[model samples]
Target chain A: MDFNPIWLTLKLACITTLLLLVIGLPVAWWLSKGRSFFKIIIEAIVTMPLVLPPSVLGFYLLLAFSPQHGAGKWLQQTFNIQFVFSFQGLVLASVIYSMPFMLGPIKSALQQLPVSLSQASYSLGKSRWQTFIRVLLPNIKPSLLTAAVLTFAHTLGEFGVVLMIGGNIPNVTRVASIAVYDAVEQMDYHAANVYSFILFAITFVLVTGVFIFNKYQLKSPLE
Target chain B: MISINIEKKIKTYQGQRILKVSGEFKSESITKIHGPSGAGKSTFLKVIAGFIQPEQGNITVNNNAWLDTVSKISLSPQKRMAGFVFQDYALFPNMTVKEHLEYATADNEWIKHLLEIGKLETLTTHKPQYLSGGQQQRLAILRALATKPQVLLMDEPFSALDPENKLALITELKLIFQELKTTVFIVSHNPQELDGIAADGAILSELYINN
Candidate 1:
């Protein structure tokens, strides 16, 4: 009946969604431009998370962030940050795991917009940055909302990556998904059911909201 | 004078075709460009507006180099300061009629004058989606003029207007172009669309590009 795991899961999802949104906007915009070999490679890397199993990503992240050697060692010594088996580690893993959910919708929406929109803005003496913020981003509101909600829901339901890199450790790293597995393993059916229902209900509401909002915005120009 | 000697390679459905245009346009005059379909008419306008970069070319506006590939000096679209009215109207769906003009210039009086010229004073609150085709087209033209640009590029500007509205709008635009001394480039399939406006001696020049 401990609610710490639920709170921690919500916090992680919120933080991951925010971080990805800030990072994804520029990356998605760059990718949405006409294709090049370099861009194609970067896009493939970004999209890999969607198709690749979460466990594979988790395994690599664990190795790369382990404090014993490599990047993990440098980060731990220089920044005094330990990514493996820590709450911060869970946040990093969730951001990577939920990246495609955040990027896919925004990228496609940007690509779908008519090129003339930017051209018109530019011809009016608007700079590229000004055009992106004032014109391009405003036209894709529905897609932005969809991306944010999907990233949040996807992060909330994370299991494999969190379990691998952020092993169940009370409030620090024990999110709802990990808590459910721990409860079931301990034969605590009631606790497991509570955590499962909460996670399921939250994700269902988020996804349903996205669908309804998108349907309402079906008449949008970008759609 | 605005002088241009530009050559660009454009990909057409048939194959790769080159668009080569060489012309000298007098400042503050209007030029009507007529060409058949797939003749890269719109592409030519875009190149002058700095939307498309020509492979090798030089564009000098009033003796100031806007683009020179040899020296690698190409001004960005912002620096070029050309106003464009797209064939599709290209109005911002999120912005209202007034916001569009306000986005371009801070002069309230100019915006008010533009609204009256387009006969869109009452529809200032409406978004492009709410406006009819003709209304949207007028808004696009009005928005372009909002910047008070020295150079204006329009592609099929009056395609959606009725004959009555088209003539009226053209009459109003003639006075405004002269008053502002704006250099204008208009592309149209219809040869007679701007007969009187471009037929004025020394004020009009005609150019034709064939695929």
Candidate 2:
């Protein structure tokens, strides 16, 4: 019933989705268009979280975020930044955990598009950036919508990584999923039911919306 | 004049074959590249357009070196500004007929003129899906011409047109080419398809590639 966790979770999801889009768009574009052995390696790394256990990813992130270690120590010494048990830590972890959800659909959509579309744009005197924005982006709306929704929902439901990297801190690290877990741990069946129902309903709606959109895309002659 | 001397190795199902070509196309003339399937006609066009990199090549358009392997100077496609009508039409599915032209240039008068020439005035608001194959082909041609490019590359441009439409469109295209002084290179499997246009002030240059 606490509102702080809900607001924090929403904030985290929003930030994570935005960051993933900024980071994932180029990655997806490369994965779709590039032809190199390194391309396969990069793709494998991106998709690792999808198959690897969430706890394993969380444990690694937790170690990397610790101030005594490589990346964390460098970040702290250079920029006075702290990751473990912080809002930034949760965002970083969520972005990594939800990357495949954001990238997979987008890459598949771009791959499905005929390479001629981009070639046409280029021959029409548009730069690669211009073509990507004005032409390629508009044609893949359904996939982009699916990516955004899935990323947002996945970040919202993230538990293992969030718990490992960001130990529960009121109004900071605590999110809706963590709140539900805490409610059950305290034997508060009523609170757990309330949080669980809310999460379940929201996720169901988002996933259903994506499926309906995917169907519409299939029926679309333009695709 | 566009002078091209390029060598590219192509990997086919059978084996690797080198695509070696060297030619000079005059300004404001139409050059037809006739070849069998898998002759790398499309790949040749792409190399000129800066899409595909040839292992060893140099393409000089209007005295500007678009691609020079020795100096490692390869201008990107946007800088080349070569209008291309792909074999598959390559029309943007999301863009309407009018939007396609609008995306290329901001000149309303030019677009109006192009719409009239392509006979797509009524279908300006229609997307590629709503149009027939011939209409789509015409749209692709119009979209390519929208840029008023100095060099135009077309790959099997008239494949979908009916005989009557083909003749009429070819006549109109000849006048446009003459007026604009545009250099054109068209690839075709059927050599006689562009005869009408060639006879009408389109100086014919042939480059044959055997599969």
Candidate 3:
């Protein structure tokens, strides 16, 4: 069985998860703790990917990534980077697509925490950054793990966005989901089953691992 | 000395009311504050600690203005460096008892001293969930003092302690405060717990009674 798509999918998931963690931590913290008029608007925008059709997001992303258009044109002239039909484009699309999966649980976990924990850290002369990294992040380990697992799994299962933006470029953007679609269209049930089974096993293991870890985390101490 | 003159509008279920307070807390002394619930006692400590912003206020500690609304100069809480023991004993759940003190200060000797003072040396490896209410309360107090802060603000610090533990802890705290020359502000529902530790005839009540 060809495993190029498998490795590509894993690579995309890993990259997307890493980037989302860096991006999601602050966004989730702000959504949960900040007092701003734009809070709801930003939250709505982050969650837009959840309810939005992937094709729609991909179409708009494709337009934005076009080297002839506004963002695309600016990018091409400025840094000579093409986003559409590239690994970078898939990364960007996956980040947007899996944002809610990463941000929602983290925000909820932070919001559930007592306000006093951060305040206590601050009173001990810890800065906001210190409190976030040392105190807040440590307390929300389960949420972080959940966010990572969900984003990785969700990114693995992505089809429409990858289809629209990635366009099934083998070894570059032909992730397992796209590979499976390709296999089916070519009357290759055996290859399709292999891809499907792998994707399914990966997602199932991740989600179940999250559940078990959550159980253990709960039994230990995470309140 | 911590001198505070502040006015804040507190919105409660009853209605909106102004919390106007002004006072000079002496340096290296303990001030006991007991008042009816919803009297902004907690809020006052928060204001002094720079956690809450008062509308019109000036907080000067040792002649340094921590907050001056007129000049729009407000220090962040990290800069304030006030050790606080919250009423709920907001210990980080993920951290062991030792880690809590470690997080506050890198001084191993200081942490050891704090743990001994709180009688938590044996439980240092235990997390908050494994601790009893009194143990948790002591941990909170110990964590606060771990920073060796010049100013210590405590809200109902002994609410969960037994009378015996309370007395012992209070005795230890008095010595700790004296040793550190810390200015202490304590909000307590049980005034008896602070009898000798608090300044004589200085137990202020209803300082911010909203009604």
Q: In model 2 chain B, where is the ten-residue run with the lowest total lDDT? A: B194-203
Q: DockQ for each candidate? A: 0.66, 0.67, 0.68
lDDT of 2 by residue, B87-194 (tens): 888889889999999999999999999999899999999999999999999999999999999999999999999999999899989988888889999999898998
Residue B127 accuracy (lDDT) in model 2: 94
The true-structure Cα RMSD of candidate 3 reads: 2.4
Question: For residues B86-153, what per-residue lDDT tens digits would candidate 3 score against the true structure?
Answer: 99899998899999999988999989888888999999899999999999999999999998988899
The TM-score of candidate 2 is 0.94
Q: How do the residues A67-120 of candidate 2 rate in per-residue lDDT, one tens digit apiece? A: 998999999999999999999999999999999999999999999988899999
Model 3 chain A: which ten-residue window has the lowest total lDDT?
A214-223
Question: 2 or 3: which has the higher TM-score?
Answer: 2
Question: What lDDT, from 0 to 1, does candidate 2 have?
Answer: 0.91
Q: What digit string (tens of lDDT, one per residue) describes model 3 on residues A18-73?
A: 99999999999989986677898889998999999999999999988888889988
Give candidate 2 misplaced runs (Cα > 4 Å). Answer: A68-70, A73-80, A221-223
Better of 1 and 2 by TM-score: 1
Query: Using lDDT as the measure, which candidate wins?
Result: 1
DockQ for candidate 1, please give it: 0.66
Write down the DockQ of candidate 2: 0.67
